[model samples]
Target: MTIQTVAKQLTRTTKYRLNNGHHIPVAGFGVYLLPPAETFDLVYEALLQGYRHIDSAVIYGNQKEAAQAIAQFVKDHENVSREDIWFTTKIWNVDHGYDETKKAVEKIALEVKESIEYVDLILVHSPLTNKEKRLGTWKALSEFNHNPNNGVLQVRSIGVSNYGKKHIEEILAIDGPVVVPAINQLELHPWLPRTELREYLTKKGIVIEAYSPLTQGRHLNDPELLELEHKYKIPKAEILLKWSYLQGFVVLAKTSKKERIKLNFEVLPEGQGTNDPLQEGSNLGKIDLDPNILDALDKPDSHLVFTWGGADPTEYED
Candidate 1:
């Protein structure tokens, strides 16, 4: 289909304002593989196509280009300021801790190019076994939040990744309220639903961000998903992204191609059953799939495992 047709069907803003009072576009575009040079135009096109939120990372190795693209977009469009953009990046595992988290933000801000000092959200890439160190890192994030003088070094919202209920409770149960983690980035898909985790976070008023909703193409070959893909007349990838949408999570999907990105953004109306979710054995409440099915997917025969980073997703028993 034509770009015009795709744009026409683009439904509600995939972006969502998080519980922390910060906003994120519902469907943020990403550039995980493009070199810095190529990323500039890809990001520019994504923003021009109505993607306000951009997802990048230091490890992804293209923040320089991504930032350049955002800068050029603002320069070309006089009315679009840096505030018009929602940017997200993660702190690498090596940088978790109070001081490192702060410096990480400082580093990302430098790459963002535009005059804006800080990105919208910065998360601890994943759970760290080093308990005391992780606490220090969170402490650093809190310092960033409470500091008014740290412009550009200041991050609007701070949170964790691949975290579980235990991890959050550990922090929150501490003396006085701490920085509430705004979103928990996790792997989510119809085949591997996070029902308990979602329910727990919902109670805490935290948003769940889904990363590998398409299971990095692992689910594409599933008998159930394939059947629904054919029935909906939508590509399987779109079906995967949409399934995450139906679960009420902010989904980040990546594509350098305008066509693929557009298709990823086309969401079906809620309750439309576009993926035929009603198929037997698809329900999370029933399926007994191993939680570590991801490792199996990464087996030699399976495709590459697509992952950004973990904040925290708790399968905490309700």
Candidate 2:
């Protein structure tokens, strides 16, 4: 598609259709490590910057602040409503059993101070917990997802984060998955693309939500990335964001700075032209990065997961 076409579509509504038939905004703001004192302000700023999707987790311990920010943003903006925003939270590692997982979800809803009906998505934070506990957690999430008369905690969708191919196989090994995962949130970026896992999930119709799409600022100084930035005349961060978007992954770009938040969402301007060598027309808009550059960005490299303390599911055992 032409850059102008892409820009128009992004502005009109860039969304990914999940397996459950629900739609999530293609771009989201993550509140992974934001301090409780600043989570509300940062999330509120992000909403003003056109971020319709906000990602949080029970482990992050900022659900209340993020939720309050969303609530306040909706109250202030007449055109926006609770349904317009996509809110995602997760069950922590400590809460890995069936009962514990259910209670964790309820606790998140209570902390957010919103009806469970308003929470858009919930996830099993990680698969590093034992197989039994992991499966039990999935069972709890499935119950909430498939139950028609579920009270207060009506999770619209359930998914996993940091789950590998083996972890997914285990989930599917059940007689029949009550609710198929709609998405898998992972630490994805050009440096550590997780190509195998992405392909595995893609074949199953599960969307990939890319966290640390910017590599947590580590790629800012990389020679290859800097070359792309200079070649495209776009900021390094924008380059990374576009790379993830072009790969058909939902990108979660997090920043506490208001200006950076706005810049992250400004992937492209409407009807703008670029000097990018990849452009064949007058209007290049925001997607000016060259295809060859993207190819180089995807080249295999040493694994570099910047956050989460190197937790791997393969090492977990009962």
Candidate 3:
């Protein structure tokens, strides 16, 4: 499809149907480096601003705060319920073996049971372990996904993170009928698009969740991004987010500021509400970049790649 076609199709509230038949919001709020003391209030504010998806992980150290925030938001809202929120958490690298993974997941389910019903999705945080342990971890997650009555861990879908072609192929090559991963959360931005892997995942029907889609605001001052910001009068991060959504990837935006959380989720700046007269005849009239600009932002040269957190586990040998 053409860039314009993709742009026209994308909206602030688009949802992608996962391979497991569950739908995930295209825009998600992530709390990666958020301070433990401030996670609750920020996450609650994100829910109040219409973010239905909350992405957290064991490594992030704020999963409990996030769960409580979701639970509280549902209780305080009129029609919202546990089902209205999509809560996702990941198993850390330390918990990569079959037994270890099971224990970690069970611990998560146990810890958050009082707050939320069940985790919407659980992903192996990274493919940092050897093949044996990686496949073993996937096996455990697959079991939990297939057997709902497996005690407390009622995960709707299971997936992987930071997995590359070889890592995914290892799971696909299993001898028996293995449950294919529903999603692959990855570090994606204009600079590191992983073109080949993205096409591979698309063909396999695995949804790609764009984690760090904004480059963690590290390179928001790129000349090209600045150009778009000036031309569109929107924040550089929004432009990067639009580029990510336009590519049919689920976007996870992390922010601690209440206003930026809303802006990131809204994809529509404060004064540019949908009812604004300027957006009358436009499709998703929030912040539509020209096709040429989108083309330029489609993954830059190798030297320009910006891997947030100073590490790219997808390329890990293990």
lDDT of 2 at 52: 86
lDDT of 3 by residue, 1-318 (tens): 345554554555555677777778767999999998999999999999988899999988889999999999998997998887899999998999899999999889876777997899999988988999999899998898988888767889999998988999999999988888889999888888888888798778888898878876678887888887887787787788888876767789998899898778777322211211111223543344665676667655542335535667777895
Q: After superposition, how far is residue 181 of candidate 1 from its true place, in Å?
A: 0.5
Segments of candidate 2 deviating more than 4 angstroms: 1-12, 113-117, 268-286, 311-318
TM-score of 3: 0.90
lDDT of 2 by residue, 1-318 (tens): 342344323431467678887888877999988998999999999888788899999889898999999999999999998888999999989999998988887787688746224578888888867888999999998988887467757788989988888888888889954567888998888777787777788778788888988878766898888887787687888888887777767889988788899898887443322221112333233455554567667756557777667654433444
lDDT of 2 at 44: 92
lDDT by residue for model 1 (246-270), tens: 5556677877677776566554331
lDDT winner between candidates 1 and 3: 3
| TM per prediction | 0.78, 0.88, 0.90
Clashing pairs in 2: none
Compare the candidates by TM-score and give the number of the best one.
3
